[model samples]
Target: MSKLFRAVIMGPPGSGKGTISERIAQSFGLKHLSSGDFVRENIAAKTEAGVQAKTYIKKGLLVPDLVMTRLLLPRLEEMTKYSWLLDGFPRTLAQAEALNSACDLDVAINLNIPLETLKERLRHRWIHPPSGRVYNMCFNPPRIQGIDDITGEPLIQQEDDRPEALVARLRHYKDVAKPVIDFYKAKGILYTFSDTETDQIWPNISTLLSTKIPTIQSDARCASTH
Candidate 1:
């Protein structure tokens, strides 16, 4: 049987994990799964897990570990036949341990972006809600200010990306993610990239994965046009 490469990406908001993940998925053949997407899907489908999560969300409470694990694990099981890249799943130490027990991870990529850079990037970030298309003022601005490029709908910044909420989110992410990073480090498969732009970090990440997995070529580049 062919080997399966399971990878998890860890980064704070506005760290370009999504862009890098898409490049990796396109360059290689790994299935890409985003935890946020999973929750959104379940909630839209009104599944049991979604209903339970919605109850907690409506009450202004975080979803329990049990519910998160129950909701995410089945999705992984369905992808047992393919190598996959996961984003935003194991946010806490408990989630990391749970994931460890479920499957072996080949590598865990940590993006160590500067706080100021993250703040600047996210502050300028706006999205098209219906399609989840993100546009950054500094990097890729839309044709019109505060407008979606594709649909021409008004774009709005996410509440969490706003200055007031960004500080708290970054603090919480650092606190919860340290142990998870340490865990992967101990396992000897932790590869970290520190940069201000996704383009700067993509080459190193591409090189690392290419070295670790024989499915890709070392000379491959994630094009800016993507």
Candidate 2:
């Protein structure tokens, strides 16, 4: 049997993590897991942990470490049979340690985007909340200004994407991510990609994965693996 390939992608907000992650998932045939989406699903379903997490979110507080580990670890445990890519979990040293204790990771991709680029991209970002479709006005405007193309509904900028909140979010991410990056670097699995655009960085990432994961059913319809 081939080894299970597990990896994590880390980046600041507006770093195009979602875009790159989607590409990586498709190109590698790995199940993409986003912690934010997982938490939202749990909260939407009113699971026990989700209910508890809701209380913290409503207060604009960080979800406690124990709660986070408890919430994510089980979901990871369930994914043991599949190679997967993780996004947006283990933000702090404690969380990283918690994750390390459970399983080894094959790679930790860190997107090093300039702060000015992040600010500009996020400032113009708008979303169709109901559909979660995001568009950057500068690069990908909708058919009608301030309107959703398909539904004709208004598109709104996320609160966190607004200028005032964005700086704080970016700073917090940097502060929390350093230790985690250092930890992975020490393990010699961390790969840092610096670029102003995801497209420029994607080729290297693709090359890296081609060497990391063995030949399997990457593009095959069957679920069997080598």
Candidate 3:
């Protein structure tokens, strides 16, 4: 079979795109390539593109499309040798067109969560700084009050999680990201999952993965794995 299972997960911040993508990647044997994480990794390695990106990043400015494209293209090319799921890139129409020209995505999964629900969910959000483990006091709180369940460290709220900042970010996301979503929709490759809750959403996602990637479902431990 051709090693060409490429997917992109898109949603506003705090919409559970990351969590859902992680679950899908692990369950389906797809490499999870998060663009934000990838850029950070590159910066850590001090690669040429990373060095270019850091100049903007350190200045608290977004990396230009050309530079980000340079940084991401190689990673996407490498993943074409195997199955992979991409997250957090193509935030603009130009970037989406560029990425499609380079490596056409097979699927674009959109996590559609209501703004009110997201605002409420993020209100209770806390995190472990070192491990980046997130806790939501509303639904998925840690076992210990204001502490990480795995470690006894106190949780901290992210600056971006603040109500005002989140609202601005989501507005920007909706404005800038709609074109990317429409591009995929026109191609008939976009899928939306209403992310009200993980439990309600996972069954549909699991079933889709099973039907789309049968090799993953054949695992005897697949049922227990989730």
Backbone N/Cα/C clashes per model: 0, 0, 0
Deviation in Å, model 2, residue 64 alpha carbon: 1.8
Give per-residue lDDT, candidate 1, residue 220: 25
- The ten-residue window of minimal lDDT in model 3 covers 215-224
- State the TM-score for model 1: 0.87
Model 3: per-residue Cα lDDT at residue 104:
66
Badly placed stretches (over 4 Å) of model 3 are 46-62, 127-133, 138-156, 215-226
lDDT of 1 at 150: 85
Cα error, residue 86 of model 2, in Å, equals: 0.4
lDDT of 2 at 195: 93
Lowest-lDDT window of 10 residues in candidate 2?
A: 217-226
lDDT of 3: 0.80
What is the lDDT for 61 in model 2?
65
Question: How much is the lDDT of residue 165 in candidate 2?
Answer: 82
Error of 2 at 81 (Å): 1.1
Model 3 C-alpha lDDT per residue in residues 1-226, reported as the tens digit of each score: 3335778888888887767877888788788787877777778889988899989877645678888888898878776678888888887888898899988677788889999888887888898765656778877789988999898989998777788988888888899899999999999989889957877887887887666665433442455555
Model 3 quality (TM-score): 0.80
Error in Å for residue 221 of model 3: 25
Write one digit per residue (lDDT tens) for candidate 1, span 1-226: 3467899999998898777888899987788898777876788899999988888866534577788899999999999988999988798889999999999998999999999999999999998866667789988899999989888889998767887778888888899899999999999989999989898999899888887777422222333224
